[model samples]
Target: MTNRLTKTLLALAVAFAMPAVSFAQDTCSNRGDLDEQYCDDNHDLTADTPTDPKKLKTPNTLVFTFTPVEDPAVYDKIFKPFTDYLSQCTAKKVVFFQVQSNAAEIEAMRSGRLHVGGFSPGPTNFAVNIAGAVPFAVIGDANGYQGYTLNVIVRKDSAIQTMEDLKGKKVAHTAPSSNSGHMAPVALFPALGVTPDKDYKVLFSGKHDQSILGVNSGDYDAAAVASDVFDRMVERGVISADNFRVIWSSEKFPTQDFAYAHDLEPNFRDKMLQCFYDYRFTDELKKAFAGADRFYPINYKKDFEMVRFVARSAGESFNRAAYDKQNAGKK
Candidate 1:
């Protein structure tokens, strides 16, 4: 979903929004394309600053937000401690922001209000390119880097006993941009005799947790999701592991990413990275992490290459044109 989001330059007027600060409304010029409103800035794309810096300045109030991967309200509690730590570590007022859609999350960062954030599987590229976030760490344990597998799960009593048994049945994939939940299944399930959109009718469940719950409730015959998310659901007693079984699992794939904005001052940037690695998950956080205990260090070029390959295999190259197209229809 976050196509070439990495290289994106935020559209000036759209990306640099400053709240509580107003601009003059433009009256339409006759016969102009409705969408074609012209904007001219000094050589730099940023809005022309006020002659005196004070007029253009906004106080720095560090904002912390997370990915839109799950219900924001619930995860707000899960991440409370981290937000508190950011407040202490950065010595700036920090607030945890919850967003309901991909666009809101992107806009928050692009507008320069967002300081640090966690981005989900596909949208990290967009957060980076359009928002100027720099990737640093991902939640993981000492055993190895944090990762998830694409799992095909079914109700414990469902007659879908094998991957081959899923033929002609209804199946759910989280969304187009999801890796373990959608892309991986499409790229790897053919050998199982289930070619999505062909052998089976595919449904969009909107999220991995929903897909997992759907399988348990018989709303779906089978669904693909991130293994860690499924495990955490069981661990939370939100669902029982015994209620379902995995019929198929794909190669291990990268987990969620943690990032900071690229425009952050240098000294502040170093401290944020240190804080991420040093913050240990307490028991409750471990529960939220599905049993993970700490943040894992990663080198994007190496750890994420396999993910890039799988995405490409599924026809998503993570380029700008594709990202714009994906974002075009989104509200």
Candidate 2:
């Protein structure tokens, strides 16, 4: 591991060891992989809304955020139109919370500071299991939900040309909880004749953009990154597709999930969901999201089945223990 990464892991260990905020303990027949504070009474594999009416929230202002896939300032501007529409639609003050990392975003919601936000696929499982985040929508259009592939990228001039060539090289994985960036690659790469930690020491780049940039700058030999993020970088002229070659690519995986805190009042939650489902993306929003034009509805239990499968295949879990271990370096 890099010196920076070693220091980061140490910091994470300390941060994750802190006690979680206390909630009244209630017995549930099946909690599944959720934290002890949450219950999965319906067996949906997500936190259920609080049974006690007093526990439900009807906040005056709604705080929103997007996944920290790239520069927060860029997304704050790109999502301005949608946030405005959400405020008008829900008749509430909406504020965009610029979270620095996946761990911060999840904690904000878990503490009831964040009302709704978009979560990347891998961290979405963590958010659901530990933060009471209920995913309800994804970026898509008439055809179906938008998806992305795992692209193992190397600079066009690099000596690394195949999966086998990655042995003994520095390979970047965005974060421990990232799907395409880490988990999926772990589950799928071995069949390609390379094992992540065994064949090559894995390095955490913290985000897909960073991984792509690292590979381009020779900071790492290659990187496993989400295709959509790579495409977005190319579209914005941040990098040229011609400059990098994808040595390997996996099948398409689901994109980020737009989720809300499970404790929101039912009527208020339904109204807010309607706002998301009804609003059409502006031209700029469409352009930023790779042609996706709307928040396509989804179910966590059904839609995330494949994501869960990959996590399991990779010997990963989204329970509290796993969350604490994996997310420490994310922030």
Candidate 3:
């Protein structure tokens, strides 16, 4: 089997591993969109902390990862300084887990192998609902939380100058669960006179960098990707701004969210959250993440309202059935 097929099979396997029925269905009065193993008693739309002490974890090591928006190795290096600081601050060994796909990352958290990580905006929904992820912070600076835009880009030499020009052309979307890469375009492009699957064939490049690189190499006639990822590539000299033109752009959306597993021991969870809140970004991290310098406080209920709106506008949900359906599409 090809590497792509292997990855798809792995994602499906993880999805199937999630329990179909709640273990504590008798206790949970509300679950919202969260999975069966989780509860949402506060109606915050995220999994609540387990009341059973036996279910709470206090690991000796904390596993951290960032969203797979680009090369995992790139972020592994970029995030090293912070992970080192986190280790000292939390008095625990911190391991930076490199995940190749969103599904793998979510599964790691759900399985209790991951302690804390940054999840991409789109997949944050699934992470919160299915993986018991509790979003608490976002990358930000003195101004506030940072945001990114969905940019439809094409080679400057390419004839596709407008959104409508993309009709019947090969266009790449980063992934099925990506916000800027796929969901935003599906919701916003129709009014602009371009529908993704209807106007052109939608191809999943699996990552924002791949989509941008594919467009650069003419493998794709156009690609919808996050502006921040595109900017980072140009800043790193991976690509030149002059070589590509953004045919269209959308409003700013929240960037990656730093979240922790909800099942962590309450005291340890608070301490870990404090460590994140108190930490500051290194100069290299600031440059790599568009000058963001700190993990700004946030809650999923308020911070993700716009994201939920976009998903709803596109007829998407964060439920397990939706996740399974999306994974099935990968096959």
Q: What TM-score, over all chains together, does every model reach?
A: 0.79, 0.91, 0.91
Runs in model 3 deviating more than 4 A are: 1-25, 329-331
- In candidate 1, how many Å is residue 74 off? 1.6
Task: Residues 1-331, candidate 1: write the lDDT tens digits.
Answer: 3755644644544566643243444432231111122221322211222234333323267777777667778778888887788678767777888987656776787677777777776666555545545567788888876778888899888888888887899899887767777777777888777788888888989888889888877889999889888877777788989888888888778788877655566656677778788888978888878678887887655676676666777777554455667778776
User: Which candidate gets the maximum lDDT versus the true structure?
Assistant: 2
The lDDT of model 2 is 0.93
Per-residue alpha-carbon lDDT of model 2 for 1-331, expressed as tens digits?
Answer: 6999999999998677654322224558789999988889999998999999999999999999999999988899999989999999999999999998999999999999999999999999999988999999999998999999999999999988899999999999998898888999899999999999999999999999999999999999999999999998988899999989999988888898899999999999999999999999999888888999999999899999999999999999999998888656534
Backbone clashes (count) for model 2: 0
Candidate 2 local Cα displacement, residue 27, angstroms: 4.2
Question: On a 0 to 1 TM-score scale, where does candidate 1 land against the true structure?
Answer: 0.79
Candidate 3 CA-lDDT value: 0.91
Off by over 4 Å in 2: 1-27, 327-331
Give the poorly placed runs of model 1, Cα more than 4 Å off: 1-59
Regarding lDDT, does 1 or 3 come out ahead? 3
